[model samples]
Target: MEEEYTLDDPTLLLQAASDFGHHPGVHSDASAKAFLHRFPLPVIINGCKNREVAKGFFMVRGWGKQKGSFSEVGCCVQTEDNRGFGFGEYFLEESRSSREMVMEETGKEFGFWEDLWWGDQPLGTQYPRLFRVVVDKNISISSVLGPSRPFSWNLNFRRNLSDSEIEDLEGLMRSLDDLYLSPSVPDARLWPLSSSGLFSVKSFFLALSQSSGSPQNFPSKFVWNSQVPFKVKSFVWLVAHKKVNTNDMLQVRRPYKALSPDICILCMKHGESADHLFLHCSLTIGLWHRLFQLAKMDWVPPRSIYDMMSIKFKGFDNSKRGIVLWQVANIALIRVVWWERNARIFEDKARNSEFLWDSIVFLASLWAFCSKAFKGIPLNVIQLDWIAVCTP
Candidate 1:
């Protein structure tokens, strides 16, 4: 005898149908009948078999109501039978009914004249209530023309208009004379943030980020240096943005933890901060002075890491290979300073100013050698005479 299977198990039903080359031979339950009725053989076969099923089972069942005309808020989808109202007329009627319902429910009237007016000039100082009352909310804009020629507003107010309101109404009509309506095209919402006028999450996020204030300039040249390692670049970027986990940042991030004597590890006289440690500390100043003296260039101290990275070198040519060495040297100095700071805090180890400056020169020479611009150059040559290597 053949194995018994119920229609409730769709897998077995499909298997039986495939075996018998027809409908499955199984007892139907209420759920199975409802499922079969809701989704016919064509739908099930098309969904499961990718329309590769035999043509014998591709039957269509028509038992429900047919859609005559489908209408959305801004656009319309019509069927073969266009035996209904146009989209404009339907939208106007629905808008008027919704306005009336809102007014009745909340005792407040809402106006959309700002949305409708697409003129080149502004509709200044006109009352929204006057626009709502004067214009027929149930009619299209093309139907608002006067009996006379030359395009006038044939307004019909529900309430008596005062002299001031009449003057404002006349100004509004003058503004509307420049407006033209295209009834054939469907309405569409455009995103002003993007060039293609399509909505995107990136554009929306940028808009929200800039809404509070002007966006700060990013130090791309400093943070995206190809000569430096990725972790060193990331650390420099954090220092530039004041996001490094110094004692001052820790105070704000963890207020409950008692971090005593929040002073700079490099210069214990001042409090520790991203700016203080990287730019203003006495030890950091000494290191910068040493690098400048080695380069034989006079420089003014910058107030912050961002200012230091953003400032352009006045006398140097940017396209020359020497500029690459200079940039790598600057980035390496920042990384070495951060390393020294962490060493003092975490390892209880310290390096004097002379040792730190030597480390900076060594690391800068090593990183500069790895760059394609400085490839095949002797490492000792770069370490001994870096100023010559950085000269155009």
Candidate 2:
């Protein structure tokens, strides 16, 4: 006997507007204004308000602005299109988490003195605790210094400074004596990833992608073939990276499941891997041989999909169009084999190697017809003599 019960709706897992509206840290007009108040340099520099400051001096946000009046400086003041000074949208999308942004701002404040060093020797490393006294009191260099030279220090420490602390502070003052604080130009945060030092979403994304330990030997040219359909190209990319859900991949993905017979479905001899399934299997070999025969070329099969995609086939006589046709055929063969394997497993259907070769030629011909080079040419002519039509 089995119990009969209806499963809870899957949509119940998703949050509703009423529920998400109450979630903390949700970006809103008021919250965006608050965030901008914490970092006001962007707001002021973008024609929001006029303020007097030293040229090339970093303007810390909330310096003289009243509390809770971020809008006064046009921080989150919305335009007619509801885009508030552009900072609100940037804060919501481009900027990191609020906590991270706050920590970055705090670090910049504490490390302000280090940036003033114009000498070859690192001042911050030599006198790390030079600004520690003022940092403890949440004091900024701008707050302490007088408007005119000789600048006066108004640092207030939590407790009486020790002899070593006093020595470090004196050294810091001597270091700052030669540094000039500009009175007109506001210090802007430069993006280090790009040459222009301007923040861009593309640069940020590229930085993240590079930092994520991506494979060095990615088959970019092979996987991104413009002749094939986007879906086929994506499938080829997965196969090239050995990320396709072959039997071995299935085993890894569902480790707890009792998936047995992890062998190449096409040959049923060796273990199923991206290399074996698409490149080394007997059925796959036959398809490759057929492709090579149709192209009227002598070739040796590569070890893996990556190797296959990486190698440039010779005998094309430096013909760019011929190379493109060869590439399209290779990609189509891979797609056709995978399709047949899936059909056999899921639909209990099978196709012979010759039939699969025909399918590959048909698929490749269809993609070729889509190209301007093959336009106005009959489909049967292209399919029958792909190499002849593409050759110079």
Candidate 3:
């Protein structure tokens, strides 16, 4: 017998009233004005005063044994809505003995945990959830008692009850399927904001989601690409390094100079392309090569930082190597890259391959050794660029 029941009465209270020439009802005009007492009353009493549901319930004056308990006067109260549903009357009129029988028989046959973190997640539809900014409240439950005893539970839709259980011990076969409920919104808070990285410039950048396309470049959590978040911190540093990379040279005679025309100030041969100056160009490649040699590693200049981390090393375990390299390189590369950027911008000249190589080597060695010794991770020069930790 699979069934669910609701106690048909919506009010959950019984109502009764009598005619109004009321006798022992509340009627007082005086308030709690501190001063003299035992004075003649200014106002008189009548039938019943209008009342709303509120908390100033009563006042107790006579101390215990000051008089007798029975002498403690209680002014009678009445409601115009006739909702004086007395608790004493309810039990005598509708004694729910039926529930006792059901509970005694159903015993421990039906049970489940309260799953607070139930909801439809927006990403990776099959997975539970990923971006849980708040605390997660979820529960795990075992199979229900089946085909042996009849038991049932229901969530009142109006009451907004969730994490409920239902069981049908008689002629039941299938296990109750796990489900997630929709979440509710809380009021917009005027609460004090904590300085827990809340007012970051990263957040300021994130606010400009639309409107400006070219100048606006920050991550958005709402319409997020899975690849974006992992690259965010590095990307932010990379974006800031632009002034460091180009320095005062941003006022180029033209934004669109043919690669064959304007010569690269570094290589002294081919023209400068945003792509070429940062990559493929001989001057930068030489710097990278010398840096790699100092670190006693073979030279392999990736087209971009994105490709840099993508290149795999063969000497170590695959998964561990990538993660270790990334962890180490993430900060070290950003710092060094910004340093290179500053040298070009402020110094008005790029360092020679040897000098650049020495800097890279120093950074790489210091970070790599620290990561291995203290952090138990490895980082390489290439892995330090603006790249993601995960592909998906």
Ranking by TM-score: 2, 1, 3
Which is the leading candidate under TM-score? 2
Give TM-scores for every candidate, taking all chains together and pairing residue i with residue i.
0.52, 0.55, 0.29
User: Could you give the candidate ranking by lDDT, starting with the highest?
Assistant: 2, 1, 3
Candidate 3 positional error at 35, Å = 48
Q: Which prediction has more favorable TM-score, 2 or 3?
A: 2
- Stretches of candidate 1 off by over 4 Å are 1-190, 201-216, 314-319
Model 2: per-residue Cα lDDT over 122-169, one tens digit each: 344466665565444334445556544687776667568889989988
Whole-model lDDT per candidate? 0.56, 0.58, 0.31
Residues 105-125 of candidate 1 have per-residue lDDT tens digits of 111111224222333311322
Q: Relative to the unseen true structure, what is the Cα RMSD of model 2?
A: 14.2
Which residue pairs collide in model 3, if any?
117-137, 148-169, 149-169, 244-341
Looking at model 3, report the run of 10 residues with the lowest lDDT sum: 63-72
- RMSD (Cα, Å) of model 3: 24.7
Clashing pairs in 2: 53-183, 54-182, 54-183, 54-184, 55-182, 55-183, 55-184, 55-185
lDDT by residue for model 3 (1-392), tens: 22111223212211101111112452211212111112221111222233333111212211111111111011222334322211111111122211111011222211122211112211112122221211222211122222233423221122322232122211112332333221232111010112331122233334433335433333222112211233544453454334323422444544564333245566667655444555556766665554344334675566654344335433112344334433343334344444565566458767766666556545544544453332432445333431232221
